[model samples]
Target: MWFSKFFILLSVWVMLSIEVESSTHWIVTESGLIQPRLNSPFDMERPYDLLAFLNQEKRWDAIFENYNDLMKHQKVIDALWFDVGEHTNSGTQILQDKDCEKAGNINAIDWHASILDDGSEKVPQEKYLFPSAYHGPSTDVPDCKRISSLTFSMFAFEHLESMMQRDNLSANPEYVLPELLTPIMTLDQFGHWVTGVLRENSSSWLHYHMASMFWRIRGNAPKALECSRRAVHYAPRAYKDIALGSLGVVLHRAGKSNDAIIVLSAAIDHDPTSFVNYFAIANAYSVIGEYNTSLKYYDDSLKLNPGMELLMRHKYGVMCQAKLSLRIKAIRETLNKLRDELNVYTQKQEAWTKLQTEFLKTIKNGEETIEKKAFERMSADNCA
Candidate 1:
């Protein structure tokens, strides 16, 4: 019985192992980079952390105060605000449903209240105020932007506008404006308002890197290249590989494959364990028809991220191309050999015909019957 149970458990374990090995998921970003999808929040990095910090209610209040202050000095147009409301049960209904027994009373019931009460009649009770229906804050804005002490509010406003344009969320009817709200802002006006603010902030290398990604997503190769170069220039030594990898990708996208290879090689030297760097360099090599080098890098990347289907697919594609090139070369060689043999055979046939003509001419002056028979025998021997 114990042996049978052990065999069954082993079989189950093998099945689970197979399932896990086959369940790799990949995502292609808007910028055309392929990456493995992270399954948990723990896998999130610094960029996501910055985004979360900027999303707090307190941060929004600070940004609003800053924007209001900016409006005093400059002829700045007001930012549009949406009054989004929550769809939920009314407060009264919530109270009724949550506390059915004491729904109408403000205080909980006391069993000895009647005994404890004095003989005097209580003064007329004031009308109880029912809780108002719940609504989302009217000052709410989409999460975007960074806060700095000097120009925090201005940057925040521009970031918000840019995000709205990037996401195409402006004029989305789901966020209805309150009737009394009167801040009129148009999409064209947003473009005019945030022109200077939309320039890439050079304060942090991470910011430039993020800007590069944004430009890539927008299909702006030149801007992406510029931002990536700045990112590489400003990145710290420890994090330089990250910036270099991004720069390489931008260069590759810009059709500078040789330059991309050089940058990606530096990235790989900085961090050999990074599979993404290997994968990127492999693609660059593939672009230049360096199949052997491309295959080597692809193999290296696959070694780091085993069982990745996308990596395998890329490696197989390169292998197919290499094989087709070899076959084409072999076919060319065979055709050349056939042509050479045909030339040699043609020359030999011409020489043989000339010799036969000379022999017939010699036989014409000799005994006609005897020479004819001799010539016929010679012809038969030559044919054989």
Candidate 2:
């Protein structure tokens, strides 16, 4: 009987689990952005060339799914690190073990010192890391620009060169160098490269999108807002919803809470299931003191991604505000009662003071009369 009951419970649990899973609507198109499962067609034994592979169908988004696989590809590694001679840091031990080419010619300059000093201060170069060397007209050192150009071209190859030729990069295009070099590149170089991309393809929302992110990181809210708006305006249909969501956030940062709410709400119309849109709209509502509406959206977003710690915190905060509102009301009521009692006590204290003064005057008069009688008795005794 126990075994039978356990089996019945297990069946019920399985059904409930399936129901929960089914409630989440996972779009295959959106899922393609994530890593493909093993044994999939994209996970073949034979690897693909970086340039050649990206030119394939829906592969631009799908390729990132195989980042580990791409890292192991010999051609991709050789293409990236063909120039790294022998300057390996402690971090490069794994690469050294793998016999990857070290960046010997790449100078180990001490970035911490602000000026190149002893070689000890110099950072040891990694194999895969490509520093952004692009410098724009503002800091246009001809020789440095030339070197930066050569270094980037050599590192990224014809992939970037081809992208530079394109007008619109948002339409199933490949943008690899920025992702690969952003971490290793100086902020100036990244900005310069993004600027160059924008100049070459002004219509490319991708470059503008990147510029918005770069400026935002640098704490330039106005520039970030401008770029974010431009990106949203020029974004392709595939990226429109995401761009709208980003624009909404930038609007919020620009102190346009109402616009942010409207934009984010519209973004939700485009992709209702997107937790980020719900989250952004909720934040906009929260900024305008619409706590209840914000809490509702927050709950909706939480339903989509229940485990998000940030969302949980936001929900908790809204609940705290709601609780605080009640607490504030109770405190106000208590304060009002105390104030009324204080007023009554103040009036009674004033009346009591008046009565006490009259009583003191009467006692003083009686004391004077007793003193007079004592004086008369003293005079009679003296006469006797």
Candidate 3:
């Protein structure tokens, strides 16, 4: 019983003896930009905390809150957030059936085949025309400066990029001008154009969904959440997953990982085939330290989008963290065993020391008795 108690105490002591190292996991460069660092080898797989980096910048809040401030600091914002030399239009294609209806008869067969490949509903061709204002400055002379549908779509995307500094542009081309006209428009003009488009297309869920992405990337969580909710309200039953996924991402960015997980789960239920939703949910789980669960979702996403290098990297990082955690656990157990052994050795040493002291005292008492007896014998002889 004593030995068991001693082992228990030794285990507790070993646990308490472990110390947590205090260290910073990021650094500020000469340009005043914060960058993440691997504080230890175990942290190599950790994800970059973008929200934390943005929070370190004093101007981010002001720029996100005020449109004028954001436009004034657009160059700085782009340098900080925008991908270098990457085209803004290279985003996920919106493959809704309604989008197929807009293409003319010449492209109808191709659109149908694409939709069919995705197992979505077949779309019927429909005639649609945009208001004259949506056209370029050459709207007055339509034949003189006629633009192809593809060029017009690219122009609208550029205008959206000018305002949002990201590719969160609405795929709908009914609310923007031609490429020839976008180059001459100022930042204020682009803002006004976006406002006008939103006002005119208040019922269009895709616009609100794109707007939510814009706000999300701009670090305006409240506005992003509001826009996401509006998008959910206006979105069709078939396309609700897009809005829900956006909401989940917004919540994750706002430091609400648990809430993000709940919303992302719902998004997955709505559209299980969307790899992006799975990836977002995986990230949410990762933030909350549910690495095993995160890995499962990451694998699910990889199955859907096999070519996603980014997802692969994230998964690899999480795996490394999981391995590190196991290693730490094994180390703690080893320390506990070593502590128990040391405690036993110390007790045996104390017992041996006590035995040696008792033996030495007995020898000293025997010597004292002999000396007393000798003195007594000498006294008797003197008396004779």
lDDT of each: 0.47, 0.48, 0.48
TM-score rank order: 2, 3, 1
Off by over 4 Å in 2: 1-186, 236-238, 254-259, 287-289, 351-384
- Give residue 305's error in model 3 in angstroms: 1.4
The best candidate in terms of TM-score: 2
TM-score of each: 0.41, 0.43, 0.42
Q: lDDT of candidate 2?
A: 0.48
- Scored against the true structure, residue 102 in model 3 reaches a CA lDDT of 34
**Candidate 1 clashes between residue pairs 3 or more apart in a chain or in different chains:** none
User: Which residue ranges in model 1 land beyond 4 Å of their true spot?
Assistant: 1-200, 339-384
True-structure lDDT of candidate 3 = 0.48
For residues 1-384, write the lDDT of model 1, one tens digit per residue.
875555445434433454353223234479764333453111223322434322322332333344334433232211111101111213334344432322233233211010101101221212111123323233322111321212322211223322223232111111222211112433222222222223433345554554455445445555544555555666677666776776666566556667678878988987787788788888888778898999999899999989775566667666655554555555565555546655654565565455434333322232342244345545755698
